[model samples]
Target: MNDHAPRRANRIALMIGHCAGMIDLVALPVWVGTLITRYGLAPQQAGLLATLFLGGAVCASLFWAPRFQRIAPERVAGWGFGIAGIAFAAMTQTSDYGAMAALHALAGLAAGSALSVTHGTIGSGEQPHRSFAMAGLALAVFGIFILGGTPVLVERAGGPALFKVFAAVMIVAALTSVAAFPRRQGATEQGQRSTAHIDSTVWYAAVGISCMGLVQAMMFSFVERIGADRGFGVAAVTGVLVALGIVNLAPAPLAALLERRWPARYVVLAGPVVQATLALIISHSSEFAPYAGATAAYAAVMIFTHTFAFGLIARLDPGGRALSATPAMLMIGAAIGPVLGGTLVQHAGYTSLGNATLAIATVAVCCFARAGRTRAVLSEA
Candidate 1:
């Protein structure tokens, strides 16, 4: 009935979809731990399973993104989440490594397809930075539930319960998408075909975001194990994760507030430095206090910086095609993170992750620097 109502509903739907789609960010620590403790998998084996999931997501996103304007995003989003729901439901039924691996890939494909559409729509908003930050704020709240609850659920019901939760969340997203997913303007969609194809800047931003994702996912996937190996018990470790979720709440809002003050370029540049520093501390610290502090703050770097990058890219590419590749941009490096990190931890040590983070962070900074300042990027606020 009101003009603002549809936009509000769209934002809410995007938030729900994001929470369901980005499960790796919220559940990786417990997910990896479950694979190791419950299924008797080696660290690399467990990390490979995670990698398979992200790789599938990357594949799906890259395929669907360029075709975004050609298709009905709502239908695609609904069907994607539905398929993911089914896959995760099946995942709850098996302990077989092969079966689980297949299911994880299927779920990632569906989830990535859905999420790319979700992010594209958000990028099409009047203020993409604020929209992304809003979605991220919701994700942070969801992270609180996930970070606090998943370990206990696994403790009581084993790893299958984790898939059950994923299934439920996906099912809910599927349902909401049918009625709430917003469609882009037809004239804009028609015009996007001609001009939006120049993607050099988009690719650079994507690479920069992906590098940060690599560091985030690598350290995140192992935080639980790292803490346990250092002799911190489950309660203490989980407390840090919960604290991490709580800390996540601030960055999005902070990014939103800073939009008027800080230049997106400077924010993007600062992100990798903060990310690598926190990651080094998180991986190398034997002390619980330092590890807890660093781990709690680490993810905030990506969240805050990515809020700026998402906004910048949306400004750079108004057609939404480039923004539609959100999953691929974020997940390409993430796909390698777990397996690479596990290999490093296996042969080298946890401390090696710090070195890896530094390397990745340097790459991210370089990419972000090249992303440059468009007139739109400079005019943010």
Candidate 2:
């Protein structure tokens, strides 16, 4: 195989696919907000609708990952993008909240499939790290879309039209992926045949990833609430989130450097520990400087932690496409975290929610530390 063949086309397709996946999420919060206004649903009910979307993703991922392994990765990814687009397009015609929720769930399912298939393809490639780096770059780009694009789209086109646009984007991405990705022989024909066993090491990585996801969900969902509690305006709250995203862009390079010297586990563990500390500080302080600093630290920690977890998982299961399983598990955790954290904030306030996040981060650090040590010893042997 020409390992050094032009991956630009494939990488671009992958980026587009990921962006399509991300656009679904970008559309969701605003869509939910619109539903609330249109239907006058209770806050909890609205939240449940959002949860259903993520819950469907979590449920589908369990089945989707294995199926992707059974099918050609490229085909699975293309179909995923296509399905997502179709689902989003369907959303434009729905007025019933129930129908909308189901459509969102379908979109989530498609996104989950796309995520697994695309990541598996990248992992199966020759230079996996570069592929991962490209994935990260895609994530960063989509992060910008999530942060800035959704609101603008909602304002200009309204929710239904916005979803239609998102659907069109997914369709384009699916076509590109189908054209760009290499054709694989067959599912059973490629990779090692290992039983679908969840090893302790993988579980540890999952837990770590879940914790990181929880922290991220809390930050994204509640940062504005926390800032408002501290007497900051909406713009100030947005600034904190924007700053976090900007600062987060730095950790990919930092993680690459750290991977050369330190084991992935150590770096992973350290990220959560730092994040927990920052969470504590953010919880206690209302000052603008301190809040900004805490947000930046939290952002850096999250990026490094995720980078380490993904890298470690990829390294540990290099023989097969098992790394695809990690994203599904991670997405499940991500789905749960926001719902749980949002509930906590509603009842107990931002301080309590922050404390809860810190506690989760602490547990993650311990789990990752143990796993890191074990991995190091195994590597040495």
Candidate 3:
């Protein structure tokens, strides 16, 4: 009982840290407008800041995460969160665009380290699918909480003051890492050696994830406008979004249950196909009900696919190095998707937008399927 108690506490702590890091990333866009107005910076400058942060995160995940097997994940995660919190706190003192951008990148690097360690731990666990599902649940709950309160927080506290809260959250994440990460089995770092080889499938998985991200983001970034174009009012669109949030919460658990009963390969393969079909349905439908239904279905499939993919990568490479790249690939895909969607919408309209995303999703689905086949061939040989 005593041994089990610590392990359980560690899991909870790790989940909290993961949730905190995700909140920080997702909440930044809410503050971009504030940064522009407060600093007298151009829109491009604000965008550049975000880009730098993401770039830092991707770099850290690539360069730092692989070393986690040697260094204790607990220590790595704790220091990362601690330093990131300090950087964010310093950000509150700066109004200079250059200074803020640099600090934000620093924070991003630290946050990425935390994320890499957390993901590594989760993905390499006994039940990777269920672990990821729990993560999705945590993210869904945190997202709902923040989305509900963000407007009020900004209005009452003003935008800049929220940085302090972000800083506090990072500190809490750091503290929680103590319980969440594995304790060192040996006193010497040299004793903690890892011998796992990097699998070729990792790169394929990264490509597949990027393609999925592109399709999902393209649709999501312009969803509100798409509804507006179809004659839906702001209220109706928002109502759908709210309903979609509720809908998104269910799939994680369902996927977790499915993981227990079905093969992971089938679960992963089905996601993109279902999402592509949903995109097609949305494309043909003009009515609010159909659009809303398609949107909700897409949300569910997206989560299911992501959870499966992340788990698959971790299971492929137990060292967690491969999973580290997941966030970077997803971000890269999402960053580019909106530009493509915007251009397509201008030239070809919503139907083309759907078709374009569907086409990309098709490629993504094929990538995963091919990867699966390749894995099977290698196993047989």
Candidate 4:
């Protein structure tokens, strides 16, 4: 095989992994209610199951990332996907809540292992930002398919059947992973080098990532209520959601095109400002058309910010050490968002929630600006 073959393979692996990871994560929202209904569990307990799954994934990703050099990434990812497929399928065999949670946790760990491999592939690429954007685009396309097909599947065969679907997808992903993700020598070499100090750029990116998670989750978690409070009916709210999902697909390609002409930093900096502005508009708008427009803008900008941040991290640290911890930051921020946002909405109101999101967005913008400036100065020096 040609030397360039591995790079091409790695790109394919990343695309598959991104799609699989998105399906695994997004499936939770559809199943959370089903878990409560079928298992006769309390709402809190059902939520805890989902949380435990995410917690396990984050911990596994963190633990396995540093060790990728020792263990071949392809091996790790292939086996991880196989194991996850088995675990997901096993969930259908048990009705016990404990067993379900345990199985889901195992799935999470395997999923994380697979995810680390894909991320490392992207981070080590020549054009990491472009690779990340492509990955995002792949996920968005897959998400649209899922959104269209899942409701029909659920109606025909209930929620647990979705596990079987995920399992089949995982199995397919596992089969291709070995060919798609060859080991990269640069990653192994970089992993062996000693590191003593932290980069300020990494911190700025981390905080921005955390803020992205926080505001996105907070807004999404209560989007329906925001619409309802504005006196929109169920059909109108559903239309707005559908519109947002469809519109969200545009950003990755747009960002890819824009980044080729303008600095990627501009895209990163613009995202938060755009999202904050849209949040304020959505919160204040009572008209359906205005609300839909603002929501769509928020979704598009949200994708840009997240993809840019992850791509930036990869470009800064190709060894994938810092990039490995990003998912944890996101999980932590997302886990906190609902609780804090709920409290603010309860006591203060939606206006307070909007203000809080704006504050976070401002901080993210400042961090991105500083990080970009620091990079410029270092390059000049």
* Cand. 3 TM to true fold: 0.78
List candidate 4 stretches off by more than 4 Å. Answer: 1-9, 24-47, 93-97, 185-198, 222-241, 277-287, 338-356, 376-381
Q: Is candidate 1 or candidate 3 better by TM-score?
A: 1
| 227: Cα error in model 3, Å | 5.8
Model 2 poorest ten-residue lDDT run: 23-32
Clashes of each: 0, 0, 1, 0
Q: Give the higher-TM-score candidate: 1 or 4.
A: 1
Compose the digit string of candidate 3's lDDT tens values, residues 243-288: 6667767877877777646655666677777877777777668998
lDDT of each: 0.86, 0.64, 0.67, 0.67
Number of the top-ranking candidate, with lDDT as the measure = 1
Q: Write the per-residue lDDT of candidate 4 for residues 1-381, one digit (tens) a residue.
A: 122435656677778876775453334333443564456665456556666555666777778766645567778778988898999899878888789889978887787778776776566545666777888787777765554455457557876777788888788778878677666555344454314243668778677767766676556555556776678975676566566667768878877776556565676788777777787777677788877788756656766777767766655665666665655656555545555655666677667767888889988888887766656323421
Worst 10 contiguous positions by lDDT, candidate 1 = 189-198
Model 1, 1-381: lDDT tens digits are 111334767768888988888888878898888899888998899999999889988998999887876788888889999999999899888889899999889988999999988887777656678878988898899999999998999999988888888899999999989878886546554234426455577688889999999998898899999999999999999999999999999999999988878888888999989999988898889899999999898787888999999888877787677888988988998899999988999999999999888888899999888886556566766
Q: Residue 74 error for model 4, in Å?
A: 1.2
